[model samples]
Target: MLKIQEIRELIKLIDKSSINEFKYENDGAKIVLKKNGSGESQLAESHAQPAAVQSVPALQPQASVPVVQQQDAMPAAEQKEKVQDETLHKIVSPMVGTFYSASAPDQPAYVKAGDKVSKDSIVCIIEAMKLFNEIESEVNGEIVEVLAENGQLVEYGQPLFLVKSE
Candidate 1:
């Protein structure tokens, strides 16, 4: 069996690497790690034990039926909002971590909605594997929305903010 620290290290290494899946088994203990298309990692573990076998049933094929698709009409306001959203730039997380809106508990948040920022502006921080990384806004714009809350667990490529670029 792997220790908690060892598992954490393995997760960090796998997340940084290009490998999509890993499996290990030893002394009836098994561990599996997988990453999906969305860049999120999943961990699975099992301790093997003896079990009784049972009979299973087979499935029969069913006839196929034609499918129809319907689209709902959107309100004018919603359509306009969507169009504006499309024009906004999204600030996304580069790695999975805990999002921090400020440098410390007593400090003010780095940026808030309606705050104007430059391409080099530091917008927030993400803590991963005990390391705090400052995240920068890559676009010059006004922050239109803050998508992640303070101390929230964020995933890689997850949008953190929406900005209206200048």
Candidate 2:
């Protein structure tokens, strides 16, 4: 298995490059990252037996990765709506994790619709591998919508919130 830092580096490199897909396999472990037409990327990892297995090893369950295909164009009405909302910016997840609207169950949400935020504001939290990560708003804007529900599973690059720029 790749270390967390290595995985982070790989994600950064892939996001900055023109490549839309990347795959790596070693010692029964595999990692795949693919980008959709909208430039959002999804990550998947699994362990597989070697092609030329000489002996049967302990069987382990495989991780399932959902495949989603997007159409090239939206319906006319949707397209018109999208055009009108072109100024909205999406705050996407930096990794696959469980989305949390607040730090704790009793705590209030970090931000809500209509809340004004600056470029460095914390918008939400994403828990991955038992670590709680604070997600920042990279753009100065007013929160328009919260896309991910509390405790929902979010994929890498999945949109968590939409903001209208100031």
Candidate 3:
């Protein structure tokens, strides 16, 4: 998929060029250019045909299977995952900027393993362009892990903090 910035660049290039038609592929997107007889540039539109899909076989239950056994298996899986939850932590981002956990100037780190944090604690700062957006923790517990590294771009729902919620 082409980024929003790349699409803007394509539009600019089409306007400046006197070529009637242009087609190029960049960043996984097919760009097409078409022009009128008078050399008027037109917006590029990519056309793609859907591929054929193969049939998939659906799983069926055997007549000999017991409903009680199936029910027991479902609960066992859930129990395993829930038990491991304590050893795991969730990382969440704070803002709409790049995420960086480490500090500059040859510093060690703002956080690490076995770190305790409160719900309102500042886990990390997200830098958007030149501004710094502080990310805060939503849970109070011990820091189990870090989800994103320093200077990593993060989306709104991107994980940035990991804590072992008590």
lDDT (10s digit) by residue, model 2, range 58-133: 1112235544655346688987767756768999998778899999999999999999999989999999879999
lDDT of 3 at 131: 77
Candidate 1 C-alpha lDDT tens digits along 35-145 = 665565666666666352111111111213423433247778888987888899999987768899999999999999999999989999998768999999999999999
- For model 3, residues 68-142, the per-residue Cα lDDT tens digits are 435355688787865775466676653356776654537666677688888877777777647776667777898
Candidate 1 matches the true fold with a TM-score of 0.60
**Candidate lDDT values, in order:** 0.78, 0.78, 0.58
Question: Which of the two, 1 or 2, has more TM-score?
Answer: 2
lDDT of 2 at 18: 99
Distance (Å) between predicted and true CA of 49, model 1? 13
Off by over 4 Å in 2: 14-23, 32-44, 49-73
The candidates, ranked best first by TM-score, are 2, 1, 3
Model 3 scores a TM of 0.45
Q: What ranges in model 1 sit over 4 Å off?
A: 1-80
What lDDT would candidate 2 get against the real structure?
A: 0.78
